[model samples]
Target chain A: MKDWKGKNLIFIGGGIAMPPIRCAIWYALENRADYGNITIVYGARTVGDLVFVDELDQWAQKERTSVIQCVDPGGETPEWKHEIGLIPHVIERSNIPAENSVALVVGPPIMIRFTLPVLDKMGMAKKDIYTSLENRMKCGIGKCGRCNCGPVYVCKEGPIFSFEQLSQLPSDY
Target chain B: MSDVIAKDDLLRLVDQWLAEGKRVLGPVKAGDGVILYAPLAASSQLVLEGFVHAANSIKEAVFPRSETIYTYKFNGHEIELSDVDPDSTQCIVIGARPCDAASLPVLDHLFNWDYKDKFYNARRAATTVVTVACSEYDDNCFCTSVGLGPAAEQGSDAMLLKAPDGWYEVRAVTDKGTALFNGKTTPAPEIKVPISDGPAKKFDTVDIETFLKNNYESDAWRDITMRCLGCGACAYNCPTCHCFDIVDEGDAAGGRRVKNWDSCQFGQFTVHASGHNPRAVQAQRQRQRIQHKFRIYPEKFGAILCTGCGTCTRNCPVSLGVLNTLEAIAAVARGSIEVK
Candidate 1:
């Protein structure tokens, strides 16, 4: 319930990390009176693999926040009224203003890579986009040298960094 | 800061530091004409008269090759996790080459930006670097091209220069270095040095971004990378090549989380569980390696990631040096194709 007034946050992918992202989203939702719109654009390879479907449905039902679910058109799923396509396609069609939006992109590197250009086309600066990096985090505090991308260790320095920071590294992550 | 420390007093300084119950890590011969940063038990252990850079950078002292991140235990179908200890130790790295020391700050920028990493930061904070100037430059060396020189002091707390009459000129650059000079440290004698202009080898990385963008799919990579063995010796030895992976291991009862080194040359680097890979070919992987260093990193930090240390060129099994790659790409962009 900490004040997030006038802040627009979005999460663009769904994986095992969805529950944690939901917890973060709900934390923002509790203070909707103080925060701006919170949107979760959950994309999965198929409808079945999309975890937390029921919970997201409940949130969308009460209109606590907006949820956009995109699945492969060929993938099986019960009838769902959300968008069906790639997450990047959904993002482009959602008409979200990139200038005022702070996106938290977490997924495989390929998915993260595909979403960046769309955000860039939507006018989001590299600094406005944050993504968590996964590496060999031998020492979470940055000593083991396993999780370092360049100057940053994904574990200690960040599991989170602006795309700008990641762009500086040699893609070791 | 105070006056410099003379070369002759180097051993006396080490003796004093050891007497004070402090440890000193310096370059020592480790066989196969290689040098490693190891503990100095005596003044003879220090190789001050050498012109070669250490085979490996001193990153291992701060970030070890392997360490436990967290421990976990399984109970029936459930699992529990426990935290590992943070690494914090005081030490001194002596006789680091200018190129190696200079890489520290660039590495620091990424590790300390958002979340503070205590592991590497703790060692970086606790460790005091003493860099030595390189008296000789080889064909593979390109420190001058990347804003670092054989004599650069980019990341040192104190710098050591070899002067005539077997004397060394040491300058303290940081508060930590100044503190080292205040207690039990004496000024080093000055030595005469010759004025020199231009390096033995020079490179112009101007407009590298545009050059790389235009040559992304050029045949130069395929032509040059044919001899590559896919071994990551270059990355493992390069001072600035930092990449790793994390994994959890143990039985159903308990296990530990560990982090270990990984390389872009591996087949699984960009592999996904769903059987998709972006850099499945050697050509793409090589491109990823070079672009990340020259194009991407420069665009991010406003500086090139490669320090031109030449470690990669020297250590590669088939000698797929980054210099050749840079030259090839640049040549192609300039409307020519050449590898020499």
Candidate 2:
């Protein structure tokens, strides 16, 4: 793993994936010295679809952190200044430096499917890119036997995985 | 303290337990071809022959299919909640198959993981399962492959092996098992534990587990796919499959919460309120069923989830048997089948 103290923590996500990555943001803030620059690149289909509105505003001002919020290109308003488009294009415009850094993407399947390759294209190693998965689960624990991604149970093994780890999983989701 | 008893004496033991004011449950012929573990009103209702297994497992006696978790009532200005207590029910499961009895301990590990499921645990505490060795075996039986046999006694309180004669060779496997028959037995001929010749021990599942772990995109899955009617019979009839859904029933302000049996085969199973469905296709749903039983579960808990009872195959509308799929996967792992 890259050194979080000097490396950038880039969060590229949207929709329901907001809260969990936001959780990581709060966590990094709790231990500011161990982490470097934290950038959150969030998007939604529309403006109202955004979540944790006040927290986003709060993190926007926090030191060593940057918050980039966007909606679909068509969702742009007259007052909006931030680039509005698909998250990957907007992230490409941000000129993110992938060296010695890790990128976390938490979003719908389409967002994950599109965003991860873009990071890969930008020279992010398979190990440095991570994503969260969603599945139907009867038991939050490993019991009721649903929430499986191939041989791995999403409930127990993970709802989280690195790009390299996910490549080894069956594409059931 | 001799432990073996004749069939007549076993029936008498049931009669005695009933006389002692305890509920006795056993597999009874439910219909023309159906058999179920039901509460026995008379000793004659107990059907110990035909090792083809019952229509249901002994799980429902403890974890019922559909049960009201709690009730809520309208009090003048506000609604009140009432939690159901699990200390009242007492039951004895008679004539459980070794596989059926074994599923309880598997369920026990799950229900008591981090947060104890009080209702299941309470009923588990109150119930004593009595498993009987098989007198026969069918083509679909595979209890031996998953590390259990007709006489394997992992979860039985008391195990009774049927001798060539009408009597059963009894042995206690636990403290509760010993308590089931303390002074009720007579000295009899010593017998070896009987093993079922069903579920030929030839089908090795080790390679299948490893293959599934390494190859997520194995074409073996497509080969096993048949035209499924999407009915939940496989999960519904399975002894080890216990997925459930919590639903609110009754009127507003005075409704009760219920736990209903759920199946992963349903399209609505993985759908989100935000209109996102992860497993939107039938193949994904079907894959989950196999992975849960053979792969995900064993890797995490070190116990094969499927008891190889063949209930899923017997209940499948499309004749998509689990054993065939497993064998095919094993073949793929062995390099017998070329990956496409």
Candidate 3:
């Protein structure tokens, strides 16, 4: 993230995956001048499933920040002002600029699986797309040995990995 | 010329160490015809022969099956926590197999890799390993395949090789060894203990590694490991399988947080709280054990996690140890077996 100065920072998060994405957005917005633009495409099963609703509105009010909220089809209510579709389809229709941008995606496996191709088609480099992973972990250090994806132990090496880094590992996790 | 110690003198030395309060661990005959590496209550309890290998490795010297890391006590709206002191008893592990001794160095990397484990390091510092060179090996022994041998001095402080007529040739490889046996050996220039060439190379490590690197999705994993009962006997008995679980065994009153040995072969080893399991099936778990020992650990720590001890196979209920799996992988790499 530090290497890509002035690059557009795009955050895509699904239900209950907002904490990490929310963290990155807060840091980027805290130093808004250091980045080019900030875009948050957040979705859940329904509006009731969304979190930090007021904070999302607050972030949308900030300069150069755009917050897009959505829900799955048929999950929206009568007053639903946002889009209605799966996260990947909504992202495709959002015209999110992939050039000179780093995307941080967080969600369940299904959300990640469908969103990657959309980001790729939008011209996001694999190295620029990051996601955090979770595995059964006991000792947060590397010794316990259960959290490994391949040669790397997620506890010590990372829970956050770029698509480029993750692609090299066996799909064990 | 070799420094020789009579078998009687060696047993006496063990008695002397026990009298001096140093913990002496060696292979002992447990009931039911099982020989295990256990703490010696007396020198007479040590079993010197008739066992190909102890049922357990000497890993318990540094990494015990279960240990308390810390304790907690609940106070009025507060909690009091106390750290457990790691056992620092001056310890000597005598009569360890060369394969068992070699696991120490391999394990050292994991304990000290980035976050230094104080407990493991403290015990390791206090323990000195005395290995006995194997004059005999069984079909399960494959130390040679993994670049180790019967008399390999990788982690032994001192080594004992069988000599003529109830004597052992003492070879001290470290200062610790020299100090322990400083005045215990008699010089016998004419005696040379013949060492057995360890078990024949069972599988090529390079070929096995190559196959593992390429065959993550192969159907061979399912076929090869179909009979694995997931009993985890192989892991529990393995010298280098160091996975563990940390649990807090307490309620509102407070209790201790302990670390216990865990096994990859267990179905719950990699299950997430959300009920998503990465390596969901038995085959995947078996593949993980092999890949971890051969490829992943070596790639990360520059050492193979296995010493080719073969205890896993010897203890495995289904006869599906790493050797059998690796041999199958080797055949697959050589194109002798086809996987759809």
Model 3, span B243-278: residue lDDT tens: 999999999899999999999999999997778788
Consecutive 10-residue window with the lowest summed lDDT within model 2 chain B:
B189-198
Off by over 4 Å in 2: A1-7, A16-38, A47-69, A73-84, A100-104, A123-130, A137-139, A150-173, B72-81, B190-199, B331-340
Clashing pairs in 2: none
Model 2 vs truth, CA RMSD? 3.7
lDDT of 3 by residue, A15-105 (tens): 9888767878888987788898889999999989998989999999999889999999988999999999999999999988888899999
lDDT by candidate, in order shown: 0.71, 0.78, 0.91
A-chain TM-score of every model: 0.86, 0.89, 0.93
lDDT of 1 by residue, B91-189 (tens): 777888878888788777656755676667877777888887787766788877777776777888887766666666667788887677565445544
Candidate 2 lDDT tens digits, A67-107: 89889977877877666899988887887878877888998
Worst 10 residues of 3 chain B by lDDT: B331-340
Candidate 3, residue B43: lDDT: 95
- The parts of candidate 3 lying over 4 Å away from their true place are A1-4, A73-81
Fraction of true contacts reproduced, model 2? Answer: 0.47
Please state the error at residue B200 of candidate 2 in Å.
2.5
Clash count in backbone of candidate 3: 0
Model 3, position B13, has a per-residue lDDT of 97
* Interface root-mean-square deviation (Å) of every model: 6.1, 2.7, 0.9
Write the residue-wise lDDT of candidate 2 on B1-340 in tens digits: 4368889989988988888878888999887768888899878889898747887778787788887779999888888999987754678889988888888877776677666888888888889988987767677788888888777788899988777678777888888888988887777655555565655674777777777676655556666664665688888878777888877887755888888888888888778666777777676677777777777777766788788777777777777757766776777777787656
Clashes of each: 18, 0, 0
